[model samples]
Target: MTPPFHSRISGLAARTLQRLRSAVSGRLIDPRNYQPPLPLPGGLSRAQIHDALTAVSIDGSASGELFGYASSDLDRFLYTLAMVPEGAVGKALEIGANPYFNTLLLRQFRPELELTLVNYFGPGSAQGKQTVSFPGFKGVADAVTFQYDNVNIESAALPYPDDSFDYVVFCEVLEHMTHDPLRSMLELKRVLKQGGTMILTTPNAARLENISAFLEGRNMYDPFSAYGPYGRHNREYTRHELHMLMTHCGFEVEASFTGNVHPDIPLGQADASTLNRLIGQVRHREHDLGQYLFTRWANARVASEKLPNWLYRSYPAERMAEGQ
Candidate 1:
């Protein structure tokens, strides 16, 4: 039998070889080749965001509560903002504010724009608790308005006046509100000005990783984690599902794209432009593989009458019966 030390060394060698093979076979995407879209002014500079995202811990040496993931968040935020016109957004509200990442970036990038950040977690309250937790507020407390209320996207009415915002940013929060996405969509529409643009980002359920997971008969999510069903991704959306949901919710989809492939995946040794070309071939529908479904939707006066029942429930019951 092999000695324990020899076995350990063999294992390490196998892992190293596997990683090298994966890199060569296109399983591992080089972070350096990731060419994100140009920033639309008032957002993190391209270099700043890219550097932040690519700064991985060598040998897992980095330390912090959210050490590795913070860059991913920044990436999503920048990508979502790319769809918005620079200096076009005036008054804006961002749903599901975690600290002030979105607002802080906006305030710095677009000083002229007024921003209100709201969260369901009260001050001092973490993600799910009803206490009070304001982790990122101390730094930018004076820069913007921060409110803590139990804002349930499924049912609770938004504590905002009608048409309160020129645009809205809903990033990475949709999949969590699994029970009543329609209600949240309507609530978002209510606060948004007519013709206002809504920038939304959510995970792609059909991502290749997820597909592989499903085929392998493994639980994709950690059941023990997250705050209730709302905290975890109860329902992820495919590109088609997202388009239909937005179109049904009285919004016109203006543009769509996929972004932020899993940081660990090596997107081949191709240049950034070449990788982007491959992405374009899928018409951004492969957002699942990329893991983010980035979309821009405009609020409309008359959404399609054939909206789903979940959306119509808040309206007249008769409208539901009439299929209007």
Candidate 2:
């Protein structure tokens, strides 16, 4: 039945407002056509990487699914590899090295370096071994069985000596630190050689897609996962915040930039351009809008004994003092 005139007018006004919002925000980019901005590293082709990843077999269904997801995000993995310095040598540690996708690539590219892998499963520490088999580039099947230490980085001290590793790959693990991120960073600092390099990568909390999601009134947080809290991203950082954290952790930033590693599925040209222009007007857009922040830092000194007040609160008064 037809409503009253005022009711009909109100409906029309609501529809108009919806359309206006759509026009202002623009449409998202088609997911199928989105391509990665960076190319594969070490002259490796996508097909080779795909074949290698597909050959990987883990024990559990959840692990298999995780590996599959890592396989799909080839660009992200390659971009991470590219950020690692070619000159990096000596002992290298990879934190949270499950599925071992990047570990395989590291072995293929940097065979000279000794590698140690770490993963967290429970509250305490233990040692275990993992064996991964994949078809080599020469069409021959190859297997890698490596020993990995199981320790909760947030709580337990790493099972290593001081200045143990020359390089540490802490990619995509920071956001999963549910309790104490500073503790993990401090532990990493303790193990890394004083002048060694550490490559780290994490999702940018201020990426363009997040901005668009916020504008559209969509929830921006990660959903609960079947794999538990560590399976989901608990905290993300902006480029600036990461730099600040790294500096506070006694690392000197050697190189840092943000880039789109994932497909531009939900971000379109119109919205990106509009936001970019708006962001540019106030300050240089820079690499602030990229999907992920990639950085290489040198271990310079001991990590801060106190947590930065900006990042934490409700702590002991002395522990919450301002950071340098």
Candidate 3:
């Protein structure tokens, strides 16, 4: 047997090695996810954190949440706004507006607009005793319109006039709650006025690495903790699954790509082009090694992040952010 001090040193070394393996995980892909956050008066409360974190942990750290994930996807969507034209959207409805989603950003992008957001509430914020509470009015007063309401049931219709809005948003909320999310998707189709914009952001279920991991039998959702596999989640979805559902619901995909992620890692003293390339490379390859990566990840995950974004199409994986 090893001496106590020697064993301690060995354990520490093993942990470090495992961390290196996990940290280097970005190399598994050349590319790319955030969750729907609840609106809290104090802002993103502990209970909200616990539930969202629990949902991600259901599949360990890998199966859910990817590097530069959410922010990148949203940014891509934002860049395309010029093509779709904001005038096409008059009033909007955002489903699952608990905390995260850049409603503030939308306010910035389309200042002359009206928006409504919706979501499930727990017992504290809910009308039903067993349901998730409803956040206090002050919680979302700053971010949401004056017309927010808690309609708790999973399959219940929204509290709004028919054809009341010109746009609908189902950002980062599909896989968390609905068992038959297609129904909700259709409901969104119903609520959207003619020629309205329907913006959605969800994880691509069939990612390259994920498909590889599945075949190799190493999914990240392997929950070894007290809770079962995929802690609070009902399912995970791929891009193809999402596309089929969206089309089936009667909305056409105007444009789509990974949104709201800053694929670059932060390296010091680089030119703007180099900085952009390095951001993706750094984010993709070395994210788990630095606090900055977590910052970028949080920004990527949250609806309104402060991460600096670049045009990803110009620097395809071939030019920079190479897989190793």
Candidate 4:
């Protein structure tokens, strides 16, 4: 028998209310559902990798909280590892590696790699040795300790001689630079061997969340951090800007794309669907809307050393003119 007309209307209204609640509350994508974009090296399983990374313990320090934050973002770290080329040998430099999540992964998967780490405490930080320990796994000991150097990449020249490293992993550090990111790029180019690769990753400024925020008339800037100026994201780059920066810095762009390393949050399905449909119409914007941007650049030519005017102002006239 068919329901009465009033009863059917009541059921429809209830269903509509439930959908509204879900749209308002939002949904979180389960981290366990993550799949690697590329095949993982060393024939390791995701479960094994998760166990090893989660097992990491940092000694007592102010950075302990920071280490915890890194632990929570396992997906981000794993994607970084996947982006790194396998069979890479020779010295690798990981800038701003204090939390040491990525450092540990590199040591585990790429045992043949001679890895050196660098961290900056602050402007007053001096170059010195500091050790970190992680639990043992295959091809590693029961406990592993790493000693890294303290150096300021933005102000001082890198302590290493030119062409010192075959691979430079400059992940998540570029956005922390308050000024003169080009200077740091030049320093990296100096340290990287000819034809060597530099893997650079940073948050995409044009990400979906930021777009949502702008549409809603909300501020999109990062909050001031207790960890000081370097603690917050000073600036973020879009995919196009990164390509231009690398080209200007004299690196041959090998491979680059944006991908979401973090789990997804509901952006209001209606709004999200509309945005996605619009983005689908534009071919260039399709790949530009991920949580993070990963790029591989090869040191091919002498750096042009020109700072694009679009990215800088209040500079010496000559420098601006040179970029123009």
Top model number, lDDT:
2
Off by over 4 Å in 1: 1-63, 122-145, 148-150, 264-288, 304-324
lDDT by residue (tens digit), candidate 4, 35-54: 22433446777666655655
- Model 3 C-alpha lDDT per residue in residues 11-37, reported as the tens digit of each score: 445444544443455332223211111
Give each model a TM-score: 0.66, 0.83, 0.49, 0.82
**Decoy 1 TM-score against native:** 0.66
State residue 4's C-alpha deviation in candidate 1, in Å: 57
* Model 1 collision count: 13
Hey, what RMSD does candidate 1 come out at?
13.0
* lDDT for position 159 in model 2: 82
Off by over 4 Å in 3: 1-29, 32-89, 123-147, 222-231, 259-324
The 10-residue segment with the lowest total lDDT in model 2 = 1-10
lDDT of 2 at 51: 70
Sort by lDDT, best first: 2, 4, 1, 3
lDDT of candidate 3 vs native? 0.41
Worst 10 residues of 4 by lDDT: 1-10
Each candidate's lDDT (Cα)? Answer: 0.58, 0.73, 0.41, 0.71
Cα error, residue 93 of model 2, in Å, equals: 0.9
Clashing pairs in 4: none
**How well does model 4 score by local distance difference test?**
0.71
- Positional deviation of residue 99's Cα in model 3 after best superposition, in angstroms: 1.2
